[model samples]
Target: MKLYKTFTSIIAFLLLTSCSVFEKNRSEQNELAYMKNIEDVAIEVSKKQYVNLLQPGDRLIILVSAQDQDVVKVFNQNYSATEQFRESSVPRGNIISNSQPINGPTYIIDGDGFIDFPVLGKIEAAGMSLDHLKQYITSSLKRYIKEPYVQARITNYRITVLGEVRNPGQFTIADGTATVLNAIGMAGDLTIYGKRDDILIVRNVNGLISKERIDLTDAGFIDSPYYFLKQGDIIYVTPNKTQERLAKRDPNSALYISIASIVVTIIALIVRK
Candidate 1:
């Protein structure tokens, strides 16, 4: 009878301990899922399209390519030799120095938001798209170089991510097409406690600063105008109270839970024996 009682007690104890551990894990998973849902909402809210306009102090890389060697030479001679030019050209097509090469003509916007091209003179580029800039340059080049192909791109299209992200810093987009969700992905997504509904997007347009709050929970974010990120845009993720509380309360919750689980299992085994 004593042996039987001991066996039944052990079984009950073991069952209770197993249930406790299972419940703890389940609670943790649920909390994690809820936090993830918040992050998803923020990402969804940032899916709106955005078009970037040029501003002063913007750097542009303009490349003019052509099939005719003489035409290419004339075009090249028009602009000052950039760093890329000094590095790429070799004698007899054999590389002499593998050092860093100079690149295309660096177009710096003057105080009037205009760049002085060799043959094009001073042209206003601010508030113009890449295509617009290309067309303007192509029209001017036609007067001098025949069959000239012009390509223009913004050399500095960067966005900043801050708050509740794994990594916070400035990131440059090579293609000039960056979205808010894209910035979050670059920052390693948001932490578990980050509030998805109250994300902040800061934008600077024509020297005026504006701020907007975004909620990521709704699927309608795709139609929002802020969906695309512009140069110098900033994305900030705020943390929820629950996450802050969890962080503040019981700094050793994970450790305590682990120790309690082990202790419970040992007690059950002893009782069984």
Candidate 2:
């Protein structure tokens, strides 16, 4: 009777340990599963789209094109076709001979939020959207070229994602606009251990830094201002409690399991004897 009780106790202990290995402390909330069994539910779409404004230390690619390429050549000093003339004291109207196209033009905004154009001189760019800046430049060129086309874009638009994700790193946004979900997807999505109900985002707009926490499990997060991420945004996926606990005791778990297995085998041997 004593041997039987000892065997039963060992079996119960082994069962508990094995079950603990697979036990997870996940939250009760479901992931992005809120819109179910509801009829005719519609959210008012926001008219405002997130636009990235120009800021200091921003690199830009401004290209001016026209029907008459030769007439517009003087205005495009930064263009590869006319880049060689910038170093030389060549007259603006006089085109340089045998100029080879090598590299694209890049305009860096100074600390004072201004860029010196080839002929327009210094112009305020910070606090202005890309479309606004393009309009300002195009309006200025009306005196020089008829139907002037100005193309402007921020070249260094980027965002970073970190923690509890498959891949965490800074991702460059080619289209100049991206959502929080898009940024997360770029980082290879959050891990199973990541907290879906609480996502953190750090944003910097016009020198003011702010932090916002969002819940991915709720559909209402789609209507939040942070749904569309801006330039220089940082996303961090927080780890769940289960992950934290596992991380703290993961190294010792193997040791504990090995010791338990040895003790169980020894007990079996003693019982057989």
Candidate 3:
């Protein structure tokens, strides 16, 4: 009976310690929202809204169209069908279609924030918005072609999400309106052991690089400055303590288990004696 009691105690202790291993460690802080209240219902979104602006090393798809087929022939690209054009219409960021072959002649922005556009020579396009650049191109093209209309978009608008996500890599924003949630979604959402409360977003502001921590579980973080993702933003979702321990190659866990077994064996021997 004494040996039976000793074995039962050892089993109970093992159960207690092993229970933490099976515990759901994901979304640990989801229930503890700092903004939570008994009367909490809805909150207003207060993120400062702004359009993405052109920057150095950014790729743009500049397309010029008019009623005149001759003008289209000189400027239009073969991105679409109808091969009466000199260059492609719009550039696909990282999309390569060997079937149709997405190829184009691009105007790379120089170090001084200028692109050597046809007829315009060096035009300042680094800081111009998409709409503003379209307007600027349209006005300049009026001298060469009547009824000049321009279509411009940033093709290299991409963000990266890494660490503790289902899928971590670079993703392109087709419309340039990607949000933090969108980036997380593209990464196949965070892993089961991911720390939802502490997410890091690294961004480049003008010439300065910055890092911001955001908590998805908190309602107030929705209206934060880092809510909206900008071009070249990199998001990193931190792992919880359980995940950290699992990732670590420490032998301390086996050591503890071995110690517990040794203690159990000593108790069994004492009880048998």
Candidate 4:
């Protein structure tokens, strides 16, 4: 009867400890869920704003079309030749000028943040919308190219992903607009232990740098102002507590568990005796 009592006591003690551990883990999981819910609310508030205008150091690909091939050729030749020159260091000057018609010119923004158009002289393009810049360029092209159609786009708008992602690096968006989620997907998505509730976005708007937090686990993120990422945006994902704890633990520390088991066994033996 005494032996039976001892066995029951041991079992009861273990059950209590096991329940405590289980409850602790459950509570932790619940806390994570609650935090994620709050994040969803923040993301829902972010999506109402449109993307800001372009900035300096942005690469632009502008296309111009006109009724006269000769007029269009002047613009097109510059871009075509520039592309060729960029692809290879070869001298584009030797290329036959009349071999290909010029459609539009391609020029990087100078340090002064200006692009020099053939007939428009120097026009301020940085911070201007594609439509507004196109209108200005089209008006000027009328003096040279009849009924000119102009289109402009930022070609090198890229986002950088860092910390806690499967892959972190600069990702280029072919389209002018890329969402925060899209940028994450390009970086191979967040890791399992990534803190989805604490994603950070660093944006430079009108020469001012702004930092924002986003939560990707909730549907509300679809409507965030930070939802659509602009050029030169940086995203940083933080690691959660679980990941940090695992990182700090030494895999070779099996001795600690062994010591704990031995101490528990000694105490049990004393109680039985």
Candidate 5:
């Protein structure tokens, strides 16, 4: 009976220690909005909204159309040429004809923040908005074709989500605009081990790279400039304190477990004796 009691005590102690180890690995259970007594309050959006400006290394798709396809054909020849160039770069296979229906041609902004347009030449498009660029191009085309219509959009607008999210990768923004929440949703939301109160956003605006740390626990970030994500924005959901502690834990945890088991067995043997 004494031996039986000693064995039961050893097992209980082992179970308690194992439970403590698991508690350390458990994730934080803090709610997303940690604000106390939060009520529905009408918050006015900031007047200074975020607008994506043209920047170097941006890919743009500019299409010109009018009542007559023949009249505007010259203005759109670059689109066909760009497609042909892309096709030629690919491996020898079933090559697509340049006459094939494609969305539009992509214009890559050069390092100097300029796209070498066919007829427009080197026009400054670095800081111009899409609407502003379209108006500028329309005015320039007026000299050649009457009633010229210009449509411009960024083709390669992408956002990257990293760190403790369920899915971490680069996602393309089809509509050319998306909010930070949209990015988080695309990444399958943050994991339980993610630091909801502290998030990092890296942005590049008009040749200037900026980093901003946002707190998801507060509703105030909804009105911040970082609310609206820009092209090539990177959102990193940092790991919570619990996750960080787990990461910093000893690499020889298995060895420690083996040593503990040996010690427990030795104690049991002595108790049996």
Candidate 6:
């Protein structure tokens, strides 16, 4: 009877702690363990500095504002005060929005990393940050339009999240304002079976692809250079061992286990009787 009771308790405990991966290692699961020894001395950790660099096949939403709307109009659908300018931009593969004079069509960078601008001709834009590109455009437009104000941003700043998350999908990082935690938050955080101590981040750095494991439970992740999720980053959260074991169990095996448990219960009852 004591042996049976012990067996039952073990099963109950296993069932209760099935997918609780974070509970297994409480000390390593801390998000900010490095802060424990800090006294009053101010310290600064190097956080992820997100800088968006333009690349080929990237689409940019470019809008130029000026004191004289007519000078800037040539860059938009109404630039020519007619459909001629709009027709010219269509062959260039720009997403046109002409109703508003200030907003220009979305420009796609060519394979050679060049974009065609009104009066400016083809300009090399790839490898330039959004701010640098904006400054370049503003400086160039100053030659024609007086005090030209340029606003440039990437049309597609997106990343993908997958595996062991409550919600896994592709999400856009509007204005490059999202972080690693923010992306996880968008995915409704990690599942109970997720290994929070080792989350994977896959990205294309320069010409090469890089894969890194980041811990969500560590505050030191804030100091990592890759903390800020870049465009096209893939965040993959691997499941803990408990989930793996659960996944490895087949339906047939589960059915057989249930049948065996029932048979054992029946035999024990018969023996008691």
TM-score of 2: 0.69
Q: Per-prediction TM-score, please?
A: 0.68, 0.69, 0.67, 0.61, 0.67, 0.63
| Candidate 4 per-residue lDDT over residues 108-188, each given as its tens digit | 777677987665678898777666787888887877776888766555666888988887888655335667766777677
What is the clash count of model 2?
0
Q: What does candidate 3's lDDT look like per residue over 1-273, in tens digits?
A: 866686878867876766655454424534333335313313344334567667777666666778886775566543443211212223233321122322334555677888767766778988887678879888888888989877665567778889988878887664565678767777788876677778999999777999999877667676777888888899999888767776686747756876887788677777777
Specify the highest-TM-score model's number. Answer: 2
lDDT of each: 0.67, 0.71, 0.68, 0.66, 0.71, 0.66
Report the error of model 2 at residue 177, Å: 2.1
Pitting candidate 3 against candidate 6, the one with the higher lDDT is: 3
Per-residue lDDT of 233-253 in model 1, one digit per residue for the tens? 899988776557666878676
Give the runs in model 1 whose Cα sits over 4 Å from its true position: 1-50, 73-102, 223-225, 267-273
In candidate 6, which residue pairs clash? 31-217, 31-219, 73-79, 74-79
Q: By summed lDDT, which 10 consecutive residues of candidate 1 come out lowest? A: 88-97
Give the per-residue lDDT digits (tens) of candidate 5, residues 1-273: 687587768767776776786666552454443323233212333343556677788787777888888988777755644432221112122221233333455688888888877688888888887778889999999988879987666657778999998888887653356778778877878988887778899998666899998887676777678888988899999887767776798756746776876787777878777
- How many Å off is the CA of 222 in candidate 6? 4.0
lDDT (C-alpha) at residue 269 in model 2: 70
lDDT-sorted candidate list, best first: 5, 2, 3, 1, 4, 6
Candidate 3: residue 73 Cα off by (Å): 3.3
Candidate 4's C-alpha runs over 4 A off are 1-49, 80-104, 204-210, 216-227, 250-273
Score residue 32 of candidate 4 by CA lDDT. 51
The ten-residue window of minimal lDDT in model 2 covers 84-93
